[model samples]
Target: MRLPLTSRRSHHRSVCVLLSALLCSGLACAQASYRIATEGTYRPWSFKDAQGALQGWDVDIANALCERMKARCEILAQDWDGIIPGLMARKYDMIVASMAITEQRRQRVDFSDKYKDTISRFVAQKGTRQDVSPSALKGKTIGVQRGSIQANYLSQNYKNSDLKFYDTPQAAELDLVAGRVEYILGNMVTYYVGFMKTAESANFAFVGPDLKGGLLGDGNGIAVRKGDVELLSKINAALAAIRADGTYDRITAKYFPFKLM
Candidate 1:
């Protein structure tokens, strides 16, 4: 028989609170396996295959990190917007998505040292001929992934442009190709290797120069709850080990042509 709503809520809280308490108590929680999160919609970074299995660089890196840490980990697919909130609620122990390390995010969570450093770029139809300046994009719709650094950059620097937000970067690119948006801003590697290289993107080209720093922050890092120093340390150590031992290179070669770490 099902329990009452209040009873269910109380039970959920009790279990989460207990887990939170253990997680904060030095390495008590680390003794157990970790629940890692990744946005499975992002290709090359993390995405689900036709059979619904999560595959890509982020998943591989997460597995490598778990192996180096000598810990078992289960990678769960989480929506990009709720990824951090899910971590805060203890739904997952850590986030291994391509989440950039920014000051705004650091207030809510602690991040492991950066694992990948890359820049952002704008993509538009070939021969479209428009710069990223506000005047050039004035009434044009610029598609971007919601809650991403590129979205923030567009909102702040191109105030006159029309912003279209999508839950995933691929959605925005789809819209761009469908003639729904004049341009889309996102990770350089994502556009270059993930999208532009594909046959569907034959008509698209990178516009403007590479964007970095100032809001984009310092690349991607693993995010853990604040004050979860033990877990953070372990993740950082594992990342360093993988990079030093050539495991990172092997993973990188499978996804990207050049080094990302």
Candidate 2:
């Protein structure tokens, strides 16, 4: 009961075609896998949980975008200062570390459309002078994260003030609590959620008016190496898709009570 040679040959060809299709699909999945970088010390944006797993607004947003793109992502915690350099070195495809979209940063890396907006502020002991003017802060000591927009703003405007820069936001907060610094400057939302709301920050309050525009930058964006148009395009598209489908809102709700964008 052997089949005709022609029939057997056709069946064999069909199997070969099926196998080839399956192999191609697998290859496509592997190709889509990407490495993404984030500043794990920045809480409510990107930070490790008690279990040491990265979980925050930025990480969730990155995950949502990857889902829209149908890509597999490996999120890595990178130091803030080295995040861009790592991307340029091809260590990661892009950075989802809530980096601001600024003229200075744009010279080194391209960015996706902003996913969130933010303002900077100064936090000091409740009884301290609330003025953020340069003259008032002239001799005061301020703790700020190194290379941040807050640090830049203070350096340019409050030149007479003493600026103490730290490698991470948490370090700055610790210094502020210990009274080593007269004030601390950082994102309003971060301080409100990560520090202000904490038990240790009970005596501290936001002093300055919300600082926006100028050197503060417009909003937070995902960063990619300069001239990485293809990856930038994909990130922008996925970001748009997630926002339109409500995935972005859902993630934001988990971390913030107010709209960031």
Error in Å for residue 204 of model 2: 1.0
- lDDT (CA) per prediction: 0.91, 0.90
Off by over 4 Å in 2: 1-31
What clash pairs does model 1 have? none
Model 2 C-alpha lDDT per residue in residues 1-261, reported as the tens digit of each score: 898999999999999999888878756636588899999999989989999999999999988888888888999999988888899999999999888888989999998998889799899999887788999988999999998888888888989999999999899999999989989999999998899989999999999698988799989899988888988899999988988988889998898898888
Instruction: Give me the overall lDDT of model 1.
Output: 0.91
Question: Could you tell me the TM-score of candidate 1?
Answer: 0.86
TM-score of 2: 0.91
Model 1, position 199: C-alpha lDDT score:
90
Clashes found in each candidate (C-alpha, N, C closer than 3 A) = 0, 0
Query: Pick by TM-score: which candidate is best?
Result: 2
Q: What's model 2's overall lDDT?
A: 0.90
